[model samples]
Target: MVAASAATCLVVTFVILTWALKDVPWRQIADGSLKPIVVLENANGTPLVRQGPYQGPYISYEQFPDTLINAVLSIEDRRFMDHIGVDPQGIVRALFRNIQAGSVVQGGSTITQQLIKLQYLDSDRTLKRKIQELVIAFWLEGKLGKEEILTRYLNSAYLGAGATGMSAAARIYFDKDVEDLNLPETALLAGLLRAPSQWNPIVNREGARQRTEVVLDAMVDNGKITHLQAGAAKSAFAKVNPTRPTPRSGSWFADWVAPQASEVSGSSPGSTTVRTTLVPRLQEIAEKTIADTLEKSGEAASVSQAALVAMTPEGAVVAMVGGRDYKASQFNRAVTAMRQPGSTFKLFVFYAALKAGLTLSDRVLDAPLDIKGWSPENSGGRYRGWVTLAEAFARSLNAASVALAQEVGLDNVIAAARELGIDAELTNTPSLALGTSEVNLLDLTAAYASVRLGKAPVEPWGIIDFKAADQPEAFRVGQQSPQPVDLSPYQSDLVDLLRLVVEKRTGRGADPGVFAAGKTGTSQNNRDAWFIGFTEPLVVGVWVGNDDDTPMKGVTGGAIPARIWRDFMRQALRNPGPDTMSDDSIAGKDNSPRSCNVSACSRAYRSFRPSDCTYQPYSGERRICER
Candidate 1:
């Protein structure tokens, strides 16, 4: 009688605990009432843009392809149809396998448990949470049909690359709907269930390919697909090319900052306002400079798109122009598109040489170089027999840069890039010295910012502070007080080298008649042109190129990109407002030609005729007008 009484009390306690844990709001998920509205603001608390919660069209179970459904079942839960909610046999099997392997190789959670975890519970792996998950899984199983459970799971799973549902993932990865997915495409999506970011096709193609193969093998093992079908799927998967559509937004900065703001707010029940680091006036100048430059020279140069990013030396991103026209294409070339940095990458090679005890006065040969059958030549096939390291850098001699990189070791060159927070994949080939490896503009610019600040890693940041719409106080973002890095022994020399490029070499077009430092880069055949430069207060990077990667007609980094950089810098430094300029004052006066007092000039040059002489605005000098 006492044992029966104890058992009754235990059952009552368990029931009460399960009841208390049931706090998920099913109605909110169904009605989309929980989506937060986000507002993005510039640095001075001016609203830049507002974003509403975006909901893609819902995909029903009937719309799902048979292969997709089978793949998910085969990889995520083999016995999903037969199990009620929790599978004791599968659990025992998983435990035995884990013990044998000495690690977690498989999971025993059913589809219902996964759904419950996604919608109702946190991801804690404690015993109490596990018990709650099991109990809730059974409750959810009794509440919904198998098809409904699977459909909800499909609609709520977080696939990487910013997709949150199968429908969105289908459009993001394949540019198709759920019902249109082929076997290999379906398998790829299924593979993401294991680890979305790790197997993301956009960022890690090889990882996605390997994970897809694993999913296909699982389907074959489960008798979902024949061996012939699996082989064909593998062949097709190898050839799949993902054309991800850019986010449809007016501003790339808005798109980039909105997600981060949402994450900061968590699941708080209100709208959010994020004050970002963008400078309104500077952003306007950057946009106009890129647009006007492209309008004037795009067709003539065969260049269709250009991007620019400007930041303070301390790493606050002040201005960003993602493209010439955001409406034409929303792709953010500054942050997303990775292209060969060309000679801009030589900065790393030279820094590594400095770390290896080489001096700017050291002589290096700029002759033709052949390393393991890969030869690099200078422009016009010209060879300066021996030049100082600084002179070679200013001239951007490809052969000399490669020779220096070889002496410093490729490993050290890669380490230098890492020290500056360049996370892009870099290979140890000889051409790496010439920047054959691809990198995005934002990271490359931030790496330069690190050098200017004498810091090891100057991470670029956007949002300054954020708060829920109804909150009384705002929470700050990013490091409030970042410590300075110990100056490298050769930091001053590196600055001098960059300044020489602007003042006396390829980047002369970038000189705004003041103290400035910059480098110019042009890839082979002039496919990409870049000018990255900095004043005392700001660092800016510019890229001019075709969207299709076609070579431009004689456009070099020193031409259009440098001109744009100089124009933008002149305007940004003109006013020097509190929000625009940093703590230190820009050293030199604006040497750009002042607009001539037209009346005074006309009085002085009495013989100047309207047809014979016209005011040249860009150069601020008069030239004879052509009829």
Candidate 2:
């Protein structure tokens, strides 16, 4: 037994010595080298934003408040001052607690070890990396006293909201210096060190409050603060308001593109310039329209959040509004939130039926429908007994849509949706015909873009190209065009259906006083509202609802969402770019007679001569030219 114990001790000592002899990054630590800076710009070369690991002013040890110091030590390392460098007691306690909880609920790294990691080592969770961390922690302790070590830790630790140190965090969160933070504020900052982005006070107030309460409780248990003090601190924390230092303009676009820029630049040593697909003017228009609409009618309609996305028919994302206010919350609803698309998903069903040999002039029943114990009804509890496919679609008759899906198999419907780039999970149930599946705004908008371009799918892109400082050549995305499914056979009929919606149905609210095509959607109990449409050159999507999936009071896709789309498109088209159609093209000046095909008329109605053909309101078939 003695021989085995001595052998184990010798092996452990030799491993420790080997790790201690490894080269320390003293020069890099002293110089404070960080990750490369990424500068994002719009398509027009206008700078959107720049992000880097910036270090703030150095604060002395004496500048830190007692409450701040105690709060951090209590939660992060309870035995920070008592242990030499690595605390075996803290490690054993953390391991036991983690085992009991069946998860990693606690960390055993001391302040010294964390500083060593921040300054000298990568964050790999390997046994060798941990031993090296411990060795470096001991070496650092030997070189500096506790006060100096704590000061450096406070100066180098990364807090949330682009802050790199306690000094920067104080200024970023409270708009004050480090010495001015009170007990509750200090506790909030300390709590952020664990998960900065998840509990950012400016973006997630409830998360921040809950984490701060945990820190206060720990302070009380550690005997650093009295129970009364902890209670008072909790009360004060509930009222704390943090400042938003990040820029609001184009922040959603910038945040979405920054990580992609870093990846495209690879591990290059210097900065990189990323030219993105964002159009600043269009982005501004989208943001203002959402804010104005929500401010005007959000509370009255019980809608607190909205997201918008606009992209060209070729799939370049020109503008995006993730939420009403990017500063209040950085959650990119346009790119992240998955909500039911409602009747907007019917587009896929109708397209599938068209491919199944059904024409727009074909008649279908719109009465009550029941399939496999599931009954679907129309909006007003009324229906046309038998109507043309165009009228049924324009009216958004759920019964007709479901029947069509049944006639052409659910697999075909799912295939149509998948062909249009909707990758959301879908079920093969009757409710699937009514868009019971959830999809994000970005992918839904991209799907519509494909329809507008006579293509089955269009992959949306943000970053156009990026150039690192040291590299001579730029890395470009979509240098080779992707092959999309050909949707030309049913393109005209699909356009006619969407146009009928705007001209004679639920999507009337979205008309921009010009030629356009789109569909309106309302989920169950009005929980999600959506309006996705397109003009000649642009496709835009809008969604309005609450974050908790609560229903809005009487809000539907045809109401606020369509109006928001209208306001934005109106402002966006005012410049008279490629979005506008000339008068001559609409009138058709040629004197020669030509047959007016209904599909061609619907697809090119903006350029179709009204004098060349007669009008038949109810008939889906085209009329012969009288000229």
Candidate 3:
């Protein structure tokens, strides 16, 4: 009677708990909005040109040969369909073996549980995650029929060497598909899932073949396959090891995409598709451009690191190469590396000058100027005493820009950069006008793209569309596209002058034909070299130097880095290709000189004006009389 009463209470408690969480939907739990996707297309609808490192041509499951599936299953888990989520007998045996082994050599969790751990849970090894796994397992048992769970598990599991799903894994491991795998091929692929990075055939064929033999031994012991068959599969695998290394795909973009991905994923980590604005073609061209430049310049011996990124008029990241090898080095210099922008920052300095009523026609003293006694020298250590703004910028004259910065005020430059989506923790010291301030490659590129995008600055983003994996139809997509960061369009004249930078000024080195505008930068001591620019359309920035602070040999921003920019922009703007300046102070529409009321404000360009001066009609101000 006592036992019966206890059982009844237990049943009641179970019923209440189930009823409470009964309404919870599994679809939400499986949704993948947490992970980011890559942007593969540019704002102008160009595809990212893929460079190198492809394992094999991608093929859908149906396109895969079926024999591969039989060989893999024959070796991996023969009772895959016969068992439920967990095999009770298998668990008891594995637990005893673990106890004997004195460690977790064997996991009782089935493929479904492993999938749950890898996909939905963190990597922390603890009791709490196990409890959650049990709950989900029970829920899964009732929610998804056995076959559905298996399919999801198999498709979601990691195979090896950056291959995540079975489809990718099969092709990568065997150069075949689930349907095409022979017995030996199946055994080899199955062995890969046990320890992908370790047992990867491309990385270690001997180890992988050994692991396959172990799986075949298990199949034989379990009576799933004959002893002769197991031996045959082993022998076949030993004879048919992968002939070459499995190449990695999308490594460059993957490196740059990881951080944004981490932000989007929040807590979960798994195979995610990051939709980038990268044009694979453009990316290849950019990468090759830098490589070719380095090779010919005799600089490749000491230089091993470089990064590049290109954007379209609307500010989409069209192509990116964060490093030479993504797997070998996870450090992404393209998006996160905060090095000195050097003189490339001049673009903003000049823009701020124009915004503050200074113009290309303005004549400023470039000789012997000091900001708070911090003297700046020209690149060649010689200054032209009196030069027009156009001549100064044409030669990338440092003294002129520093003088301009002091004249217009440093705070104005900061404000102008902010308007262009440049949020790279600025330190706007006066020397910053000469690119002394450090900034990431992405920030620098996006800032210059502001001129191309007119008044609105668009932040670089990876994933544009996402949906929960569980829902076949339901999903979330980016609606209305990227929001515009407003800029004054009346600044078209400023845009036109900035474009001349590539054609007539210091950036003449960046001229890639009829389609571009750009700027070159070399940090103090030549520790960093950079060339950031935009075509009539695309924005590109390239950085080349040592990962260490060591100065590279005979390398300059205008030479190698600028060449890379030219090569990339030339290819990016193969389509064909700015205008006059205007005032942002007057809603960017201050083109109406007739309606002007300010006496000091002038539509004509001026140089070295006092702070109180404003544009005015010839008859309007005392400054006009001085002129």
Candidate No. with top lDDT: 2
In model 1, the runs with Cα more than 4 Å from the true position are 1-34, 50-250, 480-485, 583-627
Cα deviation in Å at residue 347, candidate 3?
Answer: 1.6
lDDT of 2 by residue, 1-627 (tens): 999999999998997767754666766554444455565666765455424343445566888999999999999998988898999999999999999999999989899998888867888887778777776677667777788888878877888788888877887787677898999999999999889999999999999999999999999999999999999988988679997444423677777776766555444443566667787778878998999999999999999999999888877788889998877898999998999999999999999989899999998888887676889998989978888889888999999888888889999999999989888999999899899999999999999998898985787777666655544455444222346788899999999999989888899999999999999999999999999999997899999999999999999899999999999999988974431222121112223233333233434343332222334545476544332
Best by TM-score: 3
TM-score of each: 0.58, 0.60, 0.63
Residue runs of model 3 more than 4 Å from their true location after superposition: 1-145, 152-165, 174-252, 262-273, 298-304, 323-328, 473-491, 571-627
TM-score for predicted model 3 compared with the true structure: 0.63
Model 1 residue 134 distance off true place after TM-score fit, in angstroms: 37
Question: What TM-score would you give candidate 1 relative to the actual structure?
Answer: 0.58
Off by over 4 Å in 2: 1-23, 26-34, 50-248, 479-482, 576-627
Return the lDDT, model 1, position 410: 97
- Model 3 per-residue lDDT tens digits across residues 1-627: 999999999998688657644544357555522232222322223222233322222233444344334444444445555666566766886799899999987656666677667667767676556656667766676676665565555556677666656655665555554566677776677677667788888878788878888877766676667889888877777567564322222456655554553333223323233334444456557667766766776355366678897766555555677866566776788876789878888877777787788767888878877557788888778988888887777687888888888888889988777777677767868788887777889878877777777754556654332222221221111212245655564356556655767777666777887766667788888788888777665677889877877887766787778777777766665643211111121122322122211112322433212122223444645442122
- With a 3 Å backbone cut-off (N, CA, C), the pairs that clash in candidate 1 are none
